[model samples]
Target: MDGVLVDSETYWHRFEDEWVFAAAIEGGDPAHEEVTGMPYYEIYDYLDREYGTTVTKDEFVAAYQDRAESLYGEDVRLTEGIPALFDSLRAEGRPLAIVSSAPQSWIAIVRERFDLGPLDLVLSAEDIDEPGKPEPHIYERAAAELGAEPADCVVIEDSLNGIEAAVRAGAYTVAFRTTHNAELDLSRAEVVADGPEGLRRVFLGSE
Candidate 1:
């Protein structure tokens, strides 16, 4: 839903570098990878245990919540041709979903703002009992909710954690190229799409 559906990764990284890392941590340079694709609240927990943060968990969560409205509402741009892709998939009776590490509220704002069309399901890692991304539970749950076999689902993901989760869930994973994760290794994915058109081809089975 983030890097794959919208150009929110840049803003998210900016916020992490400028606000979260700069304001919360002391000296060492922090890579966005340290927390990228994590649930916003989970990032705080990670930071608290790893590098130690200056803010309380409540403060960290609240700050992200406060920024989310503007981030999704104004800063992010929907990916080009995605609506067309969604239409094509829906026409084929595919049950589409946006399974993310984001909390439901954050996903809700983006869905409402972008008019993402009729998604069969919108899932959050928080909806499950286990920890978020890099874990297969959320993806497993999404497949369950969709009434589909996990091995039958094709998950398009742009983050390592997301790809790992999807793969572990026994789904076919397509690694998506995005500036945010462009340099990271994506060999675990079954396939890789280099652009929106590449993604479209994958969805349409043209490649």
Candidate 2:
């Protein structure tokens, strides 16, 4: 939900640059894409495995939680036309869900702030036992919970990891381009959408 449903990625990138990459990881500079779409705990684990973490797991998780409270509560804005898009999809009998690496609490903030739904499902990476994004498990679980096959789902994502996960789950993934990911490689997705309007066209069968 970070980049797709809400524009929280730029804030997260700022946090990562100011703290995570600069101070949390030891000696190696990690790219933002390397961990952006993974769960916070998984991100710490990945960093520890690749570059060694300077902080304890609890400390890292706490930092993220603290930042998220304000980020989602006040800083983030819903994607343009998202409410209308959801309404359009609902009108067509589409089952809407938010499948994200974010925990339920964070997703809750966005949903409540935007009055996002009456959704079919809201699955977080923390809700599943399997690994998070860049892996297929999360999206696979979302499809299943919605009583649909992966091939029948249309996944919208803005991160490389998210795109990879959706693609691996056999869904027709649409890479939602944001200010932060425009230059990143998103070709693995079935379609690349410039913004909310692009997404409306893709989902509503419009040009």
Candidate 3:
């Protein structure tokens, strides 16, 4: 949801650069991709395991929660043409969902703020006990929740970890290009879409 539904990646990356990478993590500076698509709690775990953490898990989570209140509630903007695209897909009788590594609270903020709802499902990593992105379990759970097989789903993601998760889930993944991911490799995805307009072309056959 960070990049696909709302332009939250920029805000998130800023936080990572200013605080997470600089102050919270120890030793080497980890790449943003290393933790971008994992749940915030899982991010702390990953960092602690890989680079060692300077802050306690509670402190790290609190910092992210504090930043998220403003980032999702105020800073992020909805993806251009998304509402219209949702309408178009709805008209075609396609089931719609949002599968994200974000917690349900953060997803709720974005959904309520943008009035994007009446969706078939809004699955968050917090909703399942399984590991988050880069692991196929979340996407697999999302597909199951939608009453479909993983191979029958079409997942749109803007992070390498997210794409990897979907691809591993056996879905046809679309790598969405955004300012935050332009330099990241997205080759594992079955399709790469340049932007919101590219998304329209992929799902609606128009741009």
Model 3, span 86-134: residue lDDT tens: 9999999999999998888999999999999789999899989888889
Candidate 1 residue lDDT tens string, 37-78: 778787888788888888888999899988888998889998
Off by over 4 Å in 3: none
Q: Which stretches of candidate 2 lie over 4 Å from their true place?
A: none
User: Judged by lDDT against the true structure, how good is candidate 1?
Assistant: 0.87
Q: Give model 2's clash tally.
A: 0
lDDT of 2 by residue, 78-160 (tens): 88999999998899999999999999999999999999999999999999999999999998999999889999999999998
Q: What TM-score goes with each of the models? A: 0.95, 0.98, 0.98
The candidate, 2 or 3, that scores higher on lDDT is 2
Q: Order the candidates by TM-score, highest first.
A: 3, 2, 1
User: Any residue pairs clashing in model 2, and if so which?
Assistant: none
> Pick by lDDT: which candidate is best?
2
Candidate 2, residue 121: the lDDT equals 97
- Model 2 lDDT vs. the true structure? 0.93
